[model samples]
Target: MKLLKEMIHPELATRTGRILRRHAARGIVLREQDQILLLFTERYNDFSLPGGGIGEDEDMELALVRELEEETGARDIQVKAHWGYIEEYRPYWKPDYDLMHMTSHFFVCDIAPELAEVRMESYEVANGMRPVWVSIKAALDHNLQVMSRQEETMGLSIQRETFILEKISREIIF
Candidate 1:
């Protein structure tokens, strides 16, 4: 997998601690007209790509399809291309899990109009994850605002998504 981007928070780079490794699969769902499918988390007040952590020994493509359907009720997904991957290093993210090293695989996908009812996980419902479609530019702008905020209340996942969206906006949108 190509390294699309690597981000180490200023604080994390200076911290001396053990880091946990995690891998996730993410997707970029693009409609023919440039609309992007996104997951909006009301709890976090942020938007992210429709995908999640790859299960133990799970195939990356299968995990991406499963996550997209689970989160967005999407169907007839055709992964057009591999959108590369990103890595993030975060410290002080959690008390028990002091450090986190996450690598995310992203895919460019197309979904059919007919979709099954969304089957969200318990935690997803609890966190207010909902599917929404917006223009690529709008998504990028929203994420840019989130990234520019002084208070870092957004999750690292959202931050990573923001970076990915910026790249997509440059390469795909504009």
Candidate 2:
């Protein structure tokens, strides 16, 4: 996996803490028409790519497929390309978790029209995660809005997604 970008929270270096690393899988679902599939979460008032963490001993491609299906009801997806990966570091994102490091692997995928119902996780449902198809410009604009806010108040996950969206807009979307 190539490193597309590295993001470190402003305060991360200021704090003394133990760093923990986690791996996540994310996808940029682009239909033939060029619309992007994103997950809108009302809880955080943000849009994110339709994928999640890689399970232990799971293949990266398979993990992406499973996450897309679970989050967006996507089926028969064909991964077109690997968009590389990104790393993000945030200190004090959680009380129990002092320093958090995450590496996200991204893919460019195409989805089949015949889709099943979305099967979101309980927490996702509670957070109002819903699949939405929008133009790449719209997704980039929305993420920019989220990124423009104060980092102290913004959700860490949202901040990370904002970075990914911006990168996708620049590298993948025309």
Models 1 onward score TM values of 0.89, 0.87
Q: Please write out the lDDT profile of model 2 over residues 1-174, one tens digit for every residue.
A: 688888787777643467677788888876655578898888777788889889779998999999999999998988888879888887755567789788889998888876689999899999888999887777767767767874444566776677777776777766
Per-structure clash totals for the candidates: 0, 0
lDDT of 1 by residue, 21-107 (tens): 888988888766668899988777788899989988999999999999999999998888887998888775567767888889999
Show model 2 residue runs off by greater than 4 Å: 14-16, 32-34, 92-96, 149-153
> Which clashing pairs does model 1 show?
none
Ten contiguous residues with the weakest lDDT in model 1? 10-19
Q: Which of the numbered candidates is closest to the native, going by highest lDDT?
A: 1
Residue 30 miss distance in model 2 (angstroms): 1.0
